[model samples]
Target: MILTGMIFQFNKDSGEGLIMSSKGATNEFSASNWIDTSCEPSVGLKVSFEGSDTLINIEVLKDESISIVSDNKKYSASDEQKMEEFSSVDEYIEHFKSLGYKLAKDTDDGKVRTASLRRFLEDGHGEMIITSIDSKITVKTMVNGKEVK
Candidate 1:
């Protein structure tokens, strides 16, 4: 869920903050260090941490179990990206499943119909969620690899 809050303190030395949530808990998160948002939090403008614990970007705080965004700098999506590198169907299923995607048995031509906890991206090449065509090449999926996605 998206957690919205007010910034109590911003420790520039650590890039972490003491955030007082609307729901009533102070969360300490590494802001500039762990996640760099286009809109930096200014004391009490209100902020959100959606889906995951790491506040990689400033997401709209909403009343939902999950949140969506086009892209964010902090969370690397290469880890969820998959191109058909299957020796066989089982291998393909297992590999993508490892990446949190489930093969659509009914739509079994070779596209990820749904993913459990994954959002696939190609950085600049393309997007993975929009295709069912089996591709032989794919970008490496890395999260916080210290390399720009």
Candidate 2:
């Protein structure tokens, strides 16, 4: 069977490692089991191998890259692609919050503290404003604060 998992542990001196499969099983692999891979296995990198409990023919999985434009802009080509992917507002808000965003709070001046927070979200090119007022919540999704139309 072909199993996919992340390299849980790798001993560079020994060229042997253990892979923790998505099914939550760890299997040992050695350099001899390596088949077709250009890169060496490292801990936490996803890998594929064919085996049962004892994995063999281990190979590192390669990610297909999409060519993205690089420029001195707030949004990279990849960021723009991520911004356009939210099918709903909740998914959009959760993604940004996971990247470290606090709830929009009120300041001493009676103004919403969204200015600095706006920069936090905009830095990733996906603007997500979450407002909670008296138990009701509002989620505003935008690309740099202007709603995508």
Candidate 3:
């Protein structure tokens, strides 16, 4: 059976590692069992393996990229006018809150500020990420894992 998990522990000297499967089972693996030559074994790397006690045919899993589809609705003249009304990041966040979206994340560094808002959809979820850098603000939206511009 093929199982997916992350490499939680690895010892470079011994060429051995341990994988914690998504199902919570921990399995042992070694360099010989690894099948992917593109990358070396490391902790926290996602991988898939086939076996029970000792894993075999272990391979690293590649990250999936989200595809963005262009949708001009968010950039309509009325929307642009509304966006320009916000004088601060707080006001920008409040605008989305008024539309029933909830703040999912907020981060600020010395140079940049970012806020992520999310709302539940009938099928999946809708998310909007707003960023402010040097008094310039940009917005990106995604629905069901696909980004919509």
Candidate 4:
């Protein structure tokens, strides 16, 4: 069976790692199981693999980078023109849902709030990363690494 999950723990020296599947199962894996040679395994890297006891034929999945900086307000007029700001997190979430995207992950740790939405396409997938802190909301949407909406 094929399992999709994220690498929650990885040891570069040992070349061993653990995958936390979307269904909440934890599976161990090693470097040999990693099929993607282009990139090294690291924590928080999404992957797909086949196995039950030990994961094999591991493949890396596309993931976008998110940066939450304090100086986010320094955006120039051009930058502001490119950005899509929302009044509230709920409003932002609803906007993506209206665009046919489903909420993939969400986290709120008292200080920071984040929501990740995704839309699967025939060729590739689209992702949106939303972050809100101190009443400041930042939204970034990408399709196969190319920024869109």
Better of 1 and 2 by lDDT: 2
Candidate 1 — which residues are off by over 4 angstroms? 32-37, 51-56, 59-149
Give the per-residue lDDT of model 1 (tens digit) for 1-149: 55555454676766667654443345676765334244665544345664345555554343342234323223334444425665444554566555444332223445543221122221211112222336432333323222224
Model 2's alpha-carbon lDDT is 0.52
> lDDT by residue for model 2 over 106-141, one digit each (tens)?
333333323212222112323456554443445555
Give the clashing residue pairs of candidate 3, or none.
none
- Give the alpha carbon lDDT tens digit for every residue of 35-133 in model 4: 898898987676777888878899876432112112212212232144466698888888777655577689999889999876543234456788999
Per-candidate TM-scores read 0.33, 0.40, 0.44, 0.44
Candidate 2, superposed: residue stretches over 4 Å from native: 62-149
Selected candidate, larger TM-score, 1 vs 3:
3
lDDT for each residue of candidate 3 in 19-104, tens digit (9 for 90 to 100): 76544456788999999999989976767678888789898754421111121123222332355456777887888777556776
User: After superposing candidate 4, which stretches have Cα over 4 Å from the reference?
Assistant: 1-84, 146-149
Worst 10 residues of 1 by lDDT: 117-126
Ranking of models by lDDT: 4, 3, 2, 1
Candidate 3 to truth, TM: 0.44
Q: Candidate 1: global Cα-lDDT?
A: 0.42
Error of 1 at 124 (Å): 39
